[model samples]
Target: MSKTLPPAPWTRRDDLARLVAALGIENVRWVGGAVRDTLLDIEVKDIDAATPLLPDEVMARCKEADIRTVPTGIDHGTITAILPTGPVEVTTLRKDVSTDGRRATVAFASEWRDDAARRDFTINALYAHPDTLEIEDYFGGIDDLAARRVRFIGDAHQRIREDHLRILRYFRFQARFGAELDETAEAACAELAETLKGLSRERVAMELLSLLSLPDPSETVARMHRLGVLPVVLPECCKKGVEALKASIETERRESEAPDPIRRLAALLPALRPVAETVAARLRLSRQQRERLTCAAERNEGDVADPRALAYTESRECAIDRLLLQGASTTPLRGWDIPQLPMKGGEIVQRGIATGPEVARTLRAVEARWIAEGFPDRQRVEAILQEFLQKRS
Candidate 1:
């Protein structure tokens, strides 16, 4: 079946075009994400070449061409070849010999048609030429891509059985490509979400985070919740966070700045009522992210009474905290900490204050005075602290 491509003239870097041309797609086609992103007019990442050449043969050909090839998953018939242009992933055509839902056992095949048949989605199954710019669609991927819809290549349940991660990818496709999902697709995703229970948290994290970092993350997550994918993956991700984030778009340009999974995950934290430790442990977040999210959520636990709270809870994440405060209270995210206290502990010592409870009391008084003074300069603060220390003494 013929499939429609995204637009005119797919773009390819010259060196990659030449390196890929060497392999020739006579038996295989360059396919998958590159083709999909090309259709969307977005820059492609990790170029993949589908070939009929066996993994071993592909390695041989690549070596003969003086191109570096990495057996990234040679056992699965996928080899990552390195060229001066960039890293090109070369995956052989394979049929899912068996699938445990959590993982699949694939036996490499020599036919692109059979290989395309084994893939999950029509959009993902389409292949294109980097040189001649010819698009090869075995399924209706071209039409679906045109319609901005995400439908499995064959039976939705069957595809989900092959790999449960496709369930999350269903939303990822929807968010990234603005694809409207069908009933069968949503059902399949919901049905397979339970299978995610047995899958690795790291894998689940990767897919969930990809969905969260998209342009329309809130919408995608809302859909995932409707499909019941939320509790299965990020259980705590729900309406409150979505609502808070919706109006706070200006809080931070997080989508562009902190584009990583951890930052996205952090943004979701303040929306929930769970404690930082609880959220961290449940999501199986990394130590660093767990701490960051915990801190961000804690900072949001109370009203921003003064800059001291901001300085204490959000010293590092001050920008995000400020935005949240401004959104919630119509206040500005910008606030200032009192200037550095000019007087040190020695100044108190020199003032002849006893080194016990009085010293601690005097320091507190000075800090309070500084904050009340609204962050005055070092000279003023020093003079004030000296006067206060003498009074307390």
Candidate 2:
């Protein structure tokens, strides 16, 4: 059975419509995530299409249509059509000729079923006509989508063996779509979990981050832990932290907080610098991400009884992350807000303190006194600076 999707923004784009018309609708069809997401009423981020047209033909058609084209993945039969709406990736239908547990050498085919069969999961194998909104489900993807089941298209182990990353992808898709784990898929993932080590850290991090970005990734992560998958990727994770992650996700929901991968990650590991450093290096985290994670862990170590002190020591954002992690652990959050210090460097300099390190030191002393005295008035601030100057003399 086939169902029609309502007119979505992507479906109604004039530029996309013109490009499809120029290419000849018979040779092209919308495919992949865009089609699947539209059916599920999820906002489609990218529009992907599959065609029987070869790469050269795809380029020639784009030329005739006056649409810009880039051979983003030409060797793999993909061409990026730059339309007014956005870049639409059009790949020629392909069939895998061989696989080496990581990547596949493919042969371009004219059959949509061939392409569908090569996909990782049935839900991802869905396609749709560019104009008619008619869906093409060679497998029982529509039924599986409705059932909220994430299953490998054919043989689970074979599919995973073709690309070890599929193991992580399985859990990620399950988390995002609120799909239950398929038993066969789980068994295959468990058996093949170690194969994830063969994959590049960047690939692993991308999948892991995507999984963490889900509304509530705690359940899926806990399942991953149970299946012995977590240790392979995040060796620092413990049962206690995994359990804390569940409570953290609930707190996020109750407080209407946005999904925060780093904060959730902190909840899933010990709040220690070494642990953060190890995970950051292993995952190739960005410098900013690493700093934030480390700072949050540092803040979590001590009593964050004063938000101002925390803000002075780390940052406001880091303070909030610490509070969230503390809340997750059922620890009381102190310091409602970060109060600004009522002193400045110029004031210290005017108090006859030398420039550079001395001025910085005097400023810190004055700010500490102010914070300790509940942020006193400017008169008191001047008096503190005067007293500090007298002591320096």
Candidate 3:
């Protein structure tokens, strides 16, 4: 790996160049994930920098440079500078004054090493000069990155005590980038696994979903289960959930589909609607996410055989999830757009079914027949409606 921040498209942007110049190249260094990922040659999604200047000073510098600034986390000593390329988050160097395993109070400092020490993982504490692109290592972050190791900055137990969410974050980073788990870190995470319950459900859900989104997280997740971490966070996940997740990944790869976190979560859970719903609620998932998860949990034993019918009856998205979980083929649904029922209740009323409950019932009957007939054309829907009307008469 290069000793300096590797050149990438984001690094080559003219707007970023101006922003860096405005922030004073000597006063700022690219920090955190941007620096870590640049070294690892991964796709960098967000840019972050650390500066010795206070948040107000950072904002003032951006203003002088004619750059828009957002007080994204000003209380935490951070400001976001918006450039033509995108927003770059610049935070004043800070050392934790106090921590309660949830939030930290910090005082801004002028030393980069102080900020680095406050970070959770050594690999994430790397800093890179914007102009020189030279790397700065206060801890052996570069070496840790080279070793594919994800370890805490100082004491693993102390780090976990400072923020309970780091327990889940450890496994998530390991799943994505680690070749071998640091034994000390693993032990600390295991010992402090229960502390994870103290963290917010939203934070836990975010980390879990990110882990599940990875190409293959089965091994890492299984390791977490062995360490009792999974039991503490998600006792609802079945003992066989890891195997199901592996199966789900293989099925997704076979079908050439992207890995979906919610669907994979459905695989990890017991195939029961209530169980899925309960887990979703516990995780505080969005309404759409909850619906998809519960829908995937539905028992559709014989339904995967007719992909279209399954899609029509229980949504294309849910049907795809069920088929993937069942290890069935999703080829039939490729480019097969789901269609409407092709008939309306108003049209049925116009056909003299009376504008009452009869019309609604008659419409539903027609829809059921239409769905059974594979969602035929409007003419076929008309014929189905006529059959229902005749029966009602």
Candidate 4:
């Protein structure tokens, strides 16, 4: 069965048209996520084309067409064509010849079916003709797409054995597209969960972060936890964390807040500095991400009802993250609006206070008082400063 993709901006681009014309329409077709997403009515970000042409041939054709080409993954048969709209990745059809449960050694193939067979999931094994927009489902990808099912293309265990990262990809795709778990895939993942340890921390971190970024990852994560995959990947993730994540997701929906991966991650683990630090280090997160995670975890442990106090210690964004995470906890936090300090350091200095550490100390003291008094009028703040000056004199 074939379906036509509605006219999209990408379909109307001259560069894409020229490339398709140059490569010969039959030799190239849109494949992978772009096709899957278009079929799902989701916005497609990157356009990936599969071709029977070799890497050098692709490069030569692009050069002849005067289209900018970057050999982004040349050895692996990928070239990035810089179209007017954006970069489109084109890859020569390939089949895996060797596998070690962590990586694959592949040999270039001219058959589109072979390429489709090598893909991890049925929904991803789809292809569409460049000109007619006719989809070609070598597997039952169309049926799976219609059902919103995330199932491996062929044997679930074999696909996972070829690349252990597919275990995480399974959950990520399920979170992104499926409404429920595919039992066979789940069972395969459970059997192969230990193989996930062989994957690089960077790869695991990226996949986990992507999973956490979904609209609501609680259900998928709970499924992963039930299958024991979470323990293999992140031993620190606990039952309390899962519950907290569900609550945090609910609060986000109720409040219409943006999805935050770090906050969600913090909610999935104990709100302790050491736990956050350990998770950050294990995932090889950046310094800024590590610091923010630690701050959110630390702030979630104590009283964060006073926005002024939280803002004084942490930035507004950090305070909000802390509040959201803490809100998911069993303890009730005081609800308060973030307030701005009425006085500046220079203003305090002009009041006869020294411009050194003394001025900084006085500003903090006055700010504390203003917060304690619930941010009073400017006259009251002035009176407080004057009193300080008189006492110092």
Candidate 5:
């Protein structure tokens, strides 16, 4: 009951496999994305092994080999076993103990059948032995993977109730599979769409962003919206910026040089106010990705043309963002870099006859005038400041 391993540039290494076998964990198989990607002819990113070994036993064996052991999800019977080449996620087979639409409560199982039955979809349930290269498809996952159909493992509504995030994952799989959504699965998603709101914003945001990067994100996004999912995660997903981003993803896809996920999200920013950034901050995007999202959002306001006008608007990042939306290569903001102000509040105070708002007003007027004149070098800029100050005096 074994199969030959596929020819991948990267395969599970021998040293780790030998160690795991030395532990005597039965029913060892490479499972999940690693197997699915191998079938899709996509490069394998990482390896995860399912075993019947107890968590403590796996830990003991790893310790014996001097392999780095981490309780990545010890509560769920998963251990992160690190090897020199790469890290492997080793987990015991488990069945769900309970679920409340957001997450599952699981108890480790003794057999592969029990474990495979609890998975979300059929295509993901396929497992492969890294060494013997044996594939175990308990749910006909190999056939489904070959056919590109993303059929749920069991009752669609039951699966959604177990984990609402599966609703988004369903769409992502559809994109990855390049297959039409199964009729039953689509209906079940619509029936339970409202329950998706119960999921965490971070989870929803991650899934939605991934969904948008798919070949036909527009189809999935519009479908999710129709089924009442997008609004709960991002109320702004329906705005002009969102549509623009959707269009941009397709345009970029056509170019044969697809942008990475962050750039794709950069194109899909919801047309939002500065306030929306507060929501983004709350959603917990990475600092760099958040900055990109914020930069794009800030530039969403209005167009910039004049050099001095750029002074009133945003920074170089934002200015460049607006120019990108216009299909331009560079921004006018780069065309004129506004130097730091030479005149200080103290200088203004020394020239001021009062401590009222008028001093501020006069300085702004002078600065605006100078910008309109095309900000000269440091010396000319200083001269312009002096002229304004003299007038104020």
Candidate 6:
């Protein structure tokens, strides 16, 4: 008796079957996250296969089959097969020759176990034959998966040392899958936490945002703070920040909204625009992202009484962020299409106001009144403009 790959939509694809045929079904096995997720009944998004076929050979075979191929990560032995379904990566089995706590220099190997050994986690190293659907588990990945435990491949310390980004990845996977923490893995992560400094901020930001995007990452984030990991990466975050994250999660649940990582990241920082801006800059966030983070951090008490006004003033997104973090009702903002002010500066100018500063000031007065009156209709806006003009006269 042998373990079989679980049945799923991805397994029924004719294009995938053709891909396996092109590479010789016996030469390749579906590997990594696709195998891991499918077995767990998680919807598989990306498909990857491992083979002894060299990258060039993989490309040549696909070309003969009339399937296009991209030499994505060719030096790392990965070639992307463009299928009608989606791009699937076919990589040669590899063994690490050297690692610098950030990246690995690898040599292609013919053994599946060699490649599996180099992966970050046991659950991620499971493989399944394309034709037989029989699983090849060199480690106790199946048992670990059943237990909902996230464990490193070999020595936890050695695995983290091989790629320092694994420090953050450990918490992320644990947040997504683990029920009980693997103490050995946890200890290794705690000890090697400093090694995360060597990783690119972009890579760190990607992993952090991913973790936060999960349904609820408050507990995992608090654990990271306890283990001395969060401070090393984001010192701006404090105990209060973790508490704010908890509040934010509760509000998202209340509002029936999806988890927002950038908004959550804002919650995990002090409520100072400068602090949020600083963290945003350090994380290399985009201009829009930096603005959102800063906006979420700065709470105006006046806005709390009227979320729509805040939405009109700043943005619907920023208004939602403030409301959720403030433990206020996002109900007012939900499904409500933000409306534009019905009057413009040109409309004010037509009312005998001068073109320069006076027209701008009167237009602002009319817009403010319209917004304060709940984004009234065009007729009402005309009335508001008249009132402002009479007041100025």
lDDT of each: 0.69, 0.84, 0.89, 0.85, 0.71, 0.90
Task: State, as a TM-score between 0 and 1, how close model 1 is to the true structure.
Answer: 0.82
What does the lDDT read for residue 1 in candidate 6? Answer: 24
Candidate 4: clashing residue pairs, number: 0
TM-score of model 4 relative to the true fold?
0.91
Over 48-80, each residue of candidate 4 has an lDDT whose tens digit, in order, gives 999999999998998899888999999889999
List runs of model 1 lying over 4 Å from the truth.
1-11, 25-28, 249-274, 300-313, 318-322, 325-372
Q: Work out the TM-score per prediction.
A: 0.82, 0.92, 0.96, 0.91, 0.78, 0.98
- Find the candidate with the highest lDDT and give its number: 6
Top TM-score hit: 6
Model 1: per-residue Cα lDDT over 14-107, one tens digit each: 6565556567647446689888877767777667888888888888877777778789998888888776657878888898888888878888
TM for candidate 6 is 0.98
lDDT string for model 2 (214-294, tens) is 888888999999999988999899899898888878877765667888888888888889989889898999999899888
- When 5 and 6 are scored with TM-score, the better candidate is 6
Error of 1 at 105 (Å): 0.9
Q: What is the C-alpha RMSD of each candidate to the true structure, in Å?
A: 3.9, 2.8, 1.5, 3.2, 4.6, 1.3
> Model 4: how far is 279 from its true place, Å?
0.6
lDDT of 6 by residue, 184-203 (tens): 99999999999999899899
* TM-score pick, better of 3 and 5: 3
Give per-residue lDDT, candidate 2, residue 175: 87
Q: Model 5: how far is 213 from its true place, Å?
A: 4.4
Residue 90, candidate 3: how far off, in angstroms?
A: 0.4
Q: List the pairs of residues colliding in candidate 2.
A: none
Deviation in Å, model 4, residue 272 alpha carbon = 0.2
Better of 1 and 2 by TM-score: 2
**Model 2 alpha-carbon drift over 4 Å, by segment:** 301-303, 328-346, 373-380, 390-393
Backbone clashes (count) for model 3: 0
